[model samples]
Target: MGTAALVTGASSGIGRATACRLAAHGATVALLARQAEALEQVCREIRSAGGDAFVVCADLVDAVGAEQAVAQVIDRAGRLDMLINCAGAAHLSSFADDAPSQWQCMIDTNLSGTLNVSHAALSYLAAAARSDRGTADLVTVGFTAGRQSGPVTSVYAATKQAITAWSEGLRRELAPSGVRVGLIQPGLVDTPLARRLGAGPGQGLNAAVVADAIVYVVTRPAGVAVAELVVRAVGR
Candidate 1:
């Protein structure tokens, strides 16, 4: 009976936080991730808080799997009003030191994975905008590296940059259809992914900070569309 949202990477980090946030706001959330156990744990927390949540285990890097995930959300939730493309991977090493496989993994998970899920969900989002919510949302999680190049995060930056470009194009193209597309570019986030990427204890923003920005983007008044937002920790 409430807005239905599908959040990829809902197993942890920003995705998990966003799913909980949206659910707190009364939306029924569909949690998508490759880790069934983690996704189930998130679902339990949401349920404990009296929020509705369901899990759809998926590997976004697989196009078919991504489509199936989207389909499962539609089948289970009945409709999707928001799509949070938060699934991502990072490899932080100099270009020379990074293995080709590392580069490929970043490309596959961060870039291609986003594309696969977005492509599969566009139509459902559009339909939800037109019929149910009057405005649908597509929110992608980007990184500060995407806006400014950095040494160790070259490939990761490239993927985030691509997301920015793609989100811009989508924002313009979907404007007429009452669907809002936005990107959240965070400077640093304390997550497993960020830690693996070499973020220090004192560095980076909290994942909740980025999740708050995402909630702001998706909960805007129907007449207003927040196209992009950049969040950075103080003094960074």
Candidate 2:
């Protein structure tokens, strides 16, 4: 059987691109997102390309929903070989002007959402690693702000920074179990999400560029674990 991978935020942007890329590599993909219709569209595109894909619509912010999504993937695919935690949101504003709800959305989706899905998928990843795959992957998408905080990115930066530290700890903990944990920090991406953050056209890397990096990381030799990757546009 081909490898089965679960990709969160698979409705658009990096998550959507990653799902398609993984499917192109002959992996069966499970697309997870809150938008049922959008997720279905992604699945249709994948299937039309002769790649297998299914959609799991659930809000990662809800711990129960996150767990259910993982369970659904396992139920549909029989096994999971990789998880791409790419579901995230950002709200940029000065600290003084930021509303509590906006900060809460970023925290819940970017941080808590990641935690919920990873926590729910641990055992399955471990199982996959022990099987013929020999190794399993957990890839998290962070931001350049994760490495360095900047003005107007206080809460968003905090969430990415938290992911950076959390991913490192997971890398160490899962190494012996043959599960690889990797983090990708992209400088800027031209997506709706980026536009919402006030990035102008041509300001950042394309979402496809980051998706390519993720594909590279997950497809490396089983013995080679790319623990971290930082992608920045040239001369930026």
Candidate 3:
């Protein structure tokens, strides 16, 4: 009965936080993640909080996994009003230290996976956009890694850059169709994924911070499209 949202990577970190945030706002959230146990845990928490949630287990890196995840959400929820492309991996190492395969892995998960889910959700999102109730939306999460070249994250940065650029273009392309597309660029969120970066103690924003930003975007009025949100902790 309420607006519906699909959040990938909902097993943990930013995706889990974003799912909870949307559920708190009365949106029925579809959680997509590879870990069934952990993803179900998030769904349980949302249900316990008097919110609606469904879990669809899939590995986004695989060819058909993203589409399968979205299909399950559409089947259960009946429609998709929002999509959060939060599934991603960070391979942090010196450009020279990592093999080409590592970079490919990052590209497949962050870039190709986003495309897969977005393509599958387009029809439902388009239908929602045409509905009078609200504006349909698409959001992809990126990182500050792309904003700069660092000592050991060149490839990761490149991948994030690709996501940012792709999202921006998609936003413009979809803007006329009543579907709002945007990006959430978080700087060092304290997530399981960020832990892979090897940042020392106290070097990140809480996942809740990014989640709050997501809520702010999707909850806006129909005419209000939040183009992008660049959030970072103070002194980071």
What TM-score goes with each of the models?
0.97, 0.98, 0.96
Indicate the TM-score of model 2. 0.98
**Between candidates 1 and 2, the TM-score winner:** 2
Better of 2 and 3 by lDDT: 2
Q: With candidate 1 superimposed using the best TM-score fit, by how many Å does residue 211's alpha carbon deviate from the native?
A: 1.0
- Among all windows of 10 consecutive residues in model 1, the one with the lowest summed lDDT is 194-203
Candidate structures ordered by TM-score, highest first: 2, 1, 3
Candidate 1 matches the true fold with a TM-score of 0.97
Give the lDDT ranking, best first.
2, 1, 3
Alpha-carbon RMSD, candidate 2: 0.9
- Tell me, what's the RMSD of every candidate? 1.1, 0.9, 1.4
Candidates' lDDT values, in order? 0.91, 0.95, 0.88
- Model 2, 1-236: lDDT tens per residue? 38999999999889999999999999999999999999999999999999999999999999999999999999999999999999999998999999999999999999999999999999999999999979999999999999999788989999999999999999999999999999999998998898887889878998989999999999998889999999999988
Cα misplacement distance, residue 81 of candidate 2 (Å): 0.5
User: What total of clashing residue pairs does each candidate reach?
Assistant: 0, 0, 0
Instruction: Compose the digit string of candidate 1's lDDT tens values, residues 1-236.
Output: 38999999999889999899999999999999999999999999999999999999999999999999999999998998999999999888899899999999999999999999999999999999998468999999998888988888788899889888999999999999999999998888888887776778756788888888999999898879999898988888
Candidate 3 segments exceeding 4 Å error: 200-202
